[model samples]
Target: MKNQVTTIYKQAERFAEITKSAIVSGNIVRAKKCLALAERLFATGSYETKNAISNVYVFSVSTFMELRHCNISNLFPQSLKAEYLKQINTSGV
Candidate 1:
């Protein structure tokens, strides 16, 4: 479980970095590729457990918002934030 969490976090970070690069370089194709990579990471990790899925979802959404320079607070509600926080705290991803 720990290994899976660590691996997903690393991969998500890498994906975010790639997405950022794609955005800065004006490469929509590369950005889409990064988004696809992120989706795959979420789907793969989510298959391991429900908690993992939720965490990955949060990470992906947050990363996307960050990449696009959008406000996270404006995107999700407090309930979803609380749930995601619970998953994050317990899952360590």
Candidate 2:
């Protein structure tokens, strides 16, 4: 279980990196997909794993919001942003 959690955390980290690159390259679709995958991986982890990857998770979420607000507001409609915001709030991240 420890190993699996660690692996999942690492995968989330990789996804976060890819997400950052995608956002930098202005590929909002790819960035959103990567963020979703990363979030799913984070959600599946154990408590320990989630704690270990909290920074990555926070970074990914923050980047997504930044992109949504600054660069790709059109790509992410208000409704979608609200949904993501709700997820962030409920997840207690």
Candidate 3:
């Protein structure tokens, strides 16, 4: 039981790390315009456009969808959101 608890804690820590990395490395604009653009692309973009975003961030379709869902989950607090927003805005994304 102790081992299981420790393993679960480690997994949660790793998940938090990955979540931080994802927020750091992507242009996470969850605004209406960005969502609309994403919606339009998913609706009608070419395969190449579907293949990559700015040729830097790439995820399998369902993986990206899951990522989006996780980002908007209650796990993302205002402080983290503010930090991520500041980061991307400063980087001029």
Candidate 4:
């Protein structure tokens, strides 16, 4: 379980990095896809792993929000939006 969580965390981090690169290249679709994969990986981890990846997730989401120009409210997945909202509420951001 620990190894699996660690693997997931590493994969999420890699996806987060890929997401940043995609955003820099102005590839919103690729960035969104990577962010979604990262979020799903984050969700599968244990509490400790989730906490460790929370910053990465937050960074990825905020970067996406800033780079995306379309109607993101409709385009963003509800699950990820909910997670973002929950993080904001909890962190008082």
By lDDT, the best candidate is 4
Worst 10 contiguous positions by lDDT, candidate 3:
53-62
Rank list by lDDT: 4, 2, 1, 3
Ranking the candidates on TM-score from highest down gives 4, 2, 1, 3
Better of 1 and 2 by TM-score: 2
- Which candidate wins on TM-score? 4
Give per-model TM-scores: 0.43, 0.48, 0.27, 0.56
lDDT of 3: 0.40
Clashing pairs in 1: none
Candidate 3 per-residue C-alpha lDDT over 19-67 given as tens digits, one digit per residue, 9 for 90 to 100: 3454556645443234344445434656654333222222222244465
lDDT tens string, model 4, 29-76? Answer: 987776566566567867865664576655565556666653445535
Mind giving the per-residue lDDT tens digits that candidate 1 earns over 21-46? 66668776776665555445554545
Can you list the residue pairs that collide in candidate 4?
Answer: none
Residue-pair clashes per candidate: 0, 0, 0, 0
Local error of candidate 2 at residue 71 (angstroms): 6.9
- lDDT for 77 (candidate 3): 38
TM-score of structure candidate 4: 0.56
